[model samples]
Target: MQDEPTPIELTKAVADFLRSDITPLITGHQAFKLRVAVNILDLVTRQLTQEEGSDASEVERLRALLGMDGSVTELNRALAERIAKGEVDLATPGLAEHLWATTMDKLAVDQPSYASYRRELSRGE
Candidate 1:
């Protein structure tokens, strides 16, 4: 009897399928999917930065973008909550600056809210 594929192999196969076939099949949905993906990516990018040190201006800016009128602590708590709830997924490509910036540009027109938030956070205000 043939052995079944391992979990890792299965995951890789699924990823291959998504990129090679499934994604192309839904080209019409690319714009919308890209927007959602970028939004989630931006949120994770900001969260990763917080680990380096406290960026007060960034915290305030994220709060404004999220429409949360609260102190930095409250904002952090809310972000943590959102992450825990699966409202944000951090596994997308380009966790670093360059590629992520490109992805943001590609998707920004459709994801204005994310773009706005990224602008605000980057401004250090």
Candidate 2:
């Protein structure tokens, strides 16, 4: 890994700079596009910071729920196949909790500001 300012820090700084300084001088369609760019940068920063931990947690949950081991994508495909065959359902222990946790993690990265996401976070759920 490199030293000093990490990728997450650099990306976040860029987003903050655009949102604070460059945003004020733009108008109309270009301003809207600039906002989109800043939002994308913000999203990238979140993913850069959170993706590894979230993915590891998801993979662990998948392994325990499925009783097998594989890459996260492979494990997810196995889970889908089992569900499709009626082998696993909401009644399965830990299934609902795992799914909910995964969804919350995704929303945390993708839309932490979303109303329901915010509400769930407030509830410590």
Candidate 3:
């Protein structure tokens, strides 16, 4: 539905330019600030690239687990309420796997380099 240089690509370009070009021209506090900005941009790019598929998977899992249809938010809320009421727990079918997959997707956007994520990722290989 869109053209080349998609939002994620453009975001990565900006982050790359800031990291490779502008960062070297700055110093001390400004450099640190720029690094943080670039990091945020990179995170945004990752989220833009991954959010759709991750959300789809989450919705599918929630639908199957809840045995009903609704928006992702609604399904998640239902799941939360079930868990709170002791109707669902880690022992519930697919619950742990769904939670782990969802958390991994979030970490892929928030902190891909996190040690626990890295370790878990390695185990899948």
Candidate 4:
């Protein structure tokens, strides 16, 4: 029987993808998007690896870093909703792509004008 992959392996795979594949595809404002996504993923992975029990403090820290003011419960609920809606993709060889897609989707949804702004920005208009 084959052994299941460890969490570290999965996280590493995602990190590798972000550094090796996704980073090169980003340009202009999308570069910022990618950077934010990578940062979030790194935080989540760190919490998962280093902490036991629920990582509410880590989530709260992330929320604060993102300029969100919310309880850990609220942040977790939002993450769960995004995951349920297929906004976050966690099934790739690396979770990084899913994280990036989800972050972009959330940003677009939260700020309806963001996509247009990014498009214009990318065009250097």
Candidate 5:
């Protein structure tokens, strides 16, 4: 196993440092670039923290919905194909819940702070 200071922790530390310390010192286009860098770091940290669990849950949901086993990507492709062929639809058992879970996981990584996302999360939907 790895030692202390995991990737998520390290990334958060760097992002915090940049946002609190260096950002105030930068200016103009460089400031914008630094802000972008901080955002990237924050996103990376969130992924590092959440990706494994979210992906595993997604794969599990996909397997249950599709009644087959495959990697997440393969299962998703199979699902899309089935959907396109009219083999599956919103009426399928667990389909809507699976889609919602998958979408929430994506939003958790990509836009956890988005208004709608935050509202939905707060509502525990």
Candidate 6:
């Protein structure tokens, strides 16, 4: 790995700079696009920082729920197949909790400011 600032840190810094500096100077469509760009950068930073831990937790939950060993992608596919066949679902032990955790992790990265996400996050604490 490289030294000093991580990729997430660099991206976050750039996004912060854009939000604090460039965003106020523009107007109309350009400003909207700039905001979108900054948001995208922030999302990327979150994913870079959070994905590994969230994915590992998801894999562990999947292994416990399914009683199998595989990569995260494989386990997820198996889970989806089982769900489609009515073999595994919310009624299954740990299923609902696992799904909720995964969804919350995604929302944390994708839209932390979303009202419902914020409410659920606070409720968890």
- Model 1 local distance difference test score: 0.52
lDDT of 4 at 23: 98
In candidate 5, the residue pairs with backbone N, CA or C atoms under 3 Å apart (3 or more residues apart, or in different chains) clash, namely none
- Whole-model lDDT per candidate: 0.52, 0.93, 0.94, 0.59, 0.93, 0.93
- Using all chains and alpha carbons, the TM-scores for the candidates as numbered come to 0.28, 0.92, 0.93, 0.38, 0.91, 0.92
Model 5 RMSD in angstroms: 1.4
Off by over 4 Å in 1: 1-55, 91-125
Going through the candidates in the order shown, the clash numbers are: 0, 0, 0, 0, 0, 0
Better of 2 and 5 by lDDT: 2
* TM value for model 2: 0.92
Misplaced by over 4 Å in model 3 are: none
User: What are the per-residue Cα lDDT tens digits for candidate 3 across 1-125?
Assistant: 88998898899999999988898899999988998999999999999999999999999999999999998899999999999999999989999999999999999999999999999999993
lDDT of 2 by residue, 11-109 (tens): 989999999999999999999999999989988999999999999999999999999999989998999999999999999999999988999999988
lDDT of 6 by residue, 21-92 (tens): 988899999999998999899899999999999999999999999999999999999999999999997889
Error of 3 at 50 (Å): 0.9
RMSD of 6: 1.3
lDDT tens readout by residue for model 5, 35-124: 999999988998999999999999999988888999999999999999999999999999989988888998888888899989889887
Which should have the higher lDDT, number 1 or number 2? 2
lDDT accuracy of residue 113 in candidate 3: 100
Write out the backbone clash pairs for model 6.
Answer: none
User: Candidate 4, after superposition: displacement of residue 89 in Å?
Assistant: 44
**Candidate 2: pairs in clash:** none
The most accurate candidate by lDDT is 3
